[model samples]
Target: MKITIAYIEEPPFGWTGRDQAAMGADIELADVVLRAIGVSTIHHHLTSFDELLPGIQEGRWDMNVPLFVTPERAQRVAFSVPVWSIGDGFLLHCGNPKVLTSYEAVAARSDARLGIIAGQVQFESAKSAGVLDRQIVLFKDQPDAISALRAGMIDAYASTAVGNRVLAESADNAALEAVAHNNGGDGRVPIGAFSFNKSNHDLIKAVNKRLIEYLGSADHRARMERYGLTHTEIDGAIISQSAKY
Candidate 1:
């Protein structure tokens, strides 16, 4: 059987490596789990963050792995058990002058403008933190949002913690710094999972069963460390009640 997986180039989760190879913890996990279930071939479809769900819904792919499992998303796709738990992070100008570390901090500042990728979970987290719609500037992707921050168009670029770390450490972003949680409320950790087209229940069930076993194994930890994920990040993993099969 063949399985087509849709993914975006979000560091630590999904990205093309130096040799133009598809890589990242999520991809490896998907490969292992699918192959265990008799999937003879695996094809990865590189897509934009905005395209993940729509691609699945449109039958462009069999699954979208490693996306945050939001209730809104669950309505459109069948999400498997949580594969990882993630929190919000920010890419801020050097020195973090205002000491802005969380979404609550940004919300408290009337002059603050936050750059967020359109359709990302961080957008909703910002809103939940009392950030006004006007204060939240939506961008098409993380790079664009980070550019706006460097140009002073926005105070900070909001995204996943590991993602922001990758951005801050990249050669082009040496002037920026990363912080762990932007939501300010105990890390706004949300469970992430593989998204299957709603009609693919059989595939979803099989993947979920294997995923749970994989996540609890030492192999997953090895993958996490190899991908630059921190110990806290691994420990932060949580199961989502809504995502359980």
Candidate 2:
């Protein structure tokens, strides 16, 4: 069997490597689960965030790299078991001149501006935290948002805390910093999972079963660690799934 999976350039999760191969935590996880399920070949389709759901829904791909699960998104695609749980954070200029540590903090200041990728859950999260549309700027991808930040077009860029940390560490100038979301003391983090077309029940079931058996294993933990994920994120997925049952 062969499968095609869609992925976006979101580091620590998915990205196009120097050799033009899809590489990252989610990509590797998908490969393992698919191969274990008897898939003989896998195709990695590179796409933008806005296209991930629509592409899968249209059968343009068999599945997508793990993306944050939301009820609105679940309505469009079948999601596998949760793979990772992560919280939001800000990628700001080093020294954080605006002192923007949280969505609420960005909203509280009239002059504060926040950057988010178009069609991402972060936009909704920012809106829920009282950030006005006027204070928010949308970009097509991470590089554009990071460029806007470096150019002083936006005060902060919102994404997963782990991803932002990776970006900050890899940046050439060391000019960026990542600040984990405050969560307002609620400690609620979002969980992500591979998504398939609603009609692909057989494939979804197989992948979910394999994922349940694989996640949090010593080998899985070691592989994920290479992408900057620790047991905190990996085990959180298991814990979150347990709570649901």
Give lDDT tens digits, candidate 2, residues 164-200. 9888898463998999987667777899999999999
Top model number, TM-score? 2
Point to the candidate with the largest lDDT: 2
| Candidate 2: residue 81 lDDT (0-100) | 89
Q: What is the per-residue lDDT of model 1 for residues 1-245, given as tens digits with 9 covering 90 to 100?
A: 99999877777688888887788888998999999999999998888889988898999989997888878898998888777777778889989976778888888998899998889888888899899998999988666777789899998888888878877888988999999874344544777778989999899888977876777578878877777676556555643433344
Task: Quote the positional error of residue 182 for candidate 2 in Å.
Answer: 1.5
Lowest summed lDDT across 10 adjacent residues in model 1 is found at: 236-245
Worst lDDT 10-window in candidate 2: 180-189
How many steric clashes does model 1 contain?
A: 1
TM-score versus the correct structure, for each prediction: 0.89, 0.98
